[model samples]
Target: MTVTDFDFICQILRQRSGLVLGNDKAYLLESRLLPVARKYKLASFEDLVRLIRVKSDEAVIKDVVEAMTTNESFFFRDTKPFDQFKQIVLPTLMAARPNKQIRIWSAAASSGQECYSLAMILSEMAAQLSGWKIEILGTDLSTEILDRAREGIYSQFEAQRGLPINLLVKYFTQVGDRWQINQKIRSMVQYKEFNLLNDPRSLGKFDVVFCRNVLIYFDQPTKAKILNNIAGLMPNDGYLFLGGAETVLGITDKFQLLAGQRGVYGLTTGQAAPATKPAAPGALRA
Candidate 1:
């Protein structure tokens, strides 16, 4: 593809999904969008861009944007966040909220693994959360992945990564060569199609949010906007989990690193009214 074609595609991605593509990413565009070009029976990437130029379709834009959006995720990705969540965050929150209700958002939840991981951890504390209300919301921009997440199935290799053997055995039943998260864990979470670039207020507020590993794609301004919107929906004492490589430092002041915790953040001050009970699972689908 010519530089002009590459730049056009990059512009389209940025407009559609807030992905910032640099001039050096020509190879990446070819690697990811070539198959999309072929799928539409276009002769080459140039032809794909030509089609978009002449007759832009919303579906085509969506396909190209989703094709470029990174959906890398796995169960308990990066051990420290889950450890902090299970060990300190949950305990402190439980003590503070005697109502015994918890709501968590797995932002950019690629395929529900992270959400289910949270469920399993909570389930392990079932005796303590026996009468409590718990809801896990898993949202992603890709409809296809959200569908897969709802199905609760994973390949052996996918399950092996970050999923401990004992927990895997307890929570998943082998189906032929693949593993499926048990219905009990699956029922505790719900999936929805969401975009971080859009306003997030409609999704309702969350006490614990897992918006991990997704902000690095955006430019600094876009990143700041997204972090502010995320903060807008969290209570003062709420917790936010970002990827280890991502941080709030030099980004936004809405959150600060939780005291004595790594990869965990808390609101700086002020509290939103706690979210009411979440609707039954499947009701929040986009």
Candidate 2:
């Protein structure tokens, strides 16, 4: 691809998905978009670029953006975050929420592992949250991945990643060589296609947000904008979990690191809650 073609694609990705692609990633564009070109019956990569530039086809653009975005995820990735969710976030939210309801959002929820992992944790604590309404919403920019997440199927390798033996036995059933999460666990979460660059207020308030491992690809200003928009969707005492490599420091003042917690954050004092909290959609009664 020429310099013009590479820059154009990078700009579209950044604008649509808040992803920052450097000049070094030209190889990535070629590798990831080549299949997209073949799928569309385009003759060559240049044809794909021409289709994008001249026709400005929305479908092609969407595919290009989704293709470039990474969807790397695994069950209970990085044990500490899930541990913190179970031990800290849950207990605090349970005590504070008088309605016995909690909503969780898994941003960039690739293939639904993160959402199901949380569902399994809630299922294990069913006795404690017997009558509570718990909702888990998993959102990704790619509709294709969200479909896979809703299906809740995983390869043997996927099922084994950070998934404990007992929980695996308890929650999944083997189908051929792959595993599918039980319907009960699958029903506990909902998946939707969402972009971080857009406003999140429409999704309603979330008690906890697991936006782990997503911001490393964006520039500082994009990171700050996304963080602020997320802050708008959270209550003052709400919890935010970022990737181990990501942080809110210097990005935005809307949130502050939770004391003694490495990757957890809470809204700053000056951050104001929405006038009225909207009810979360598709809540499951536990």
Top lDDT hit: 2
lDDT of 1 by residue, 1-286 (tens): 8988888899988877899998888989888988888989998888888888999977777888988998888887877677777766777788778888888999999888899889988888889888899889999999988999999999999999888788888889999999999999999999999998899999998989998998889999988999999999987889899998899889999988876566788888944223333234322111
lDDT of 2 by residue, 34-91 (tens): 9999999998778899999899999999999999889999887877777777777787
For each candidate, the alpha-carbon lDDT, in order, equals: 0.85, 0.87
TM-score versus the correct structure, for each prediction: 0.92, 0.93
In model 2, how large is the Cα lDDT of residue 281?
A: 29
lDDT of the structure predicted as candidate 2 = 0.87
At residue 16, candidate 2 shows an lDDT of: 89
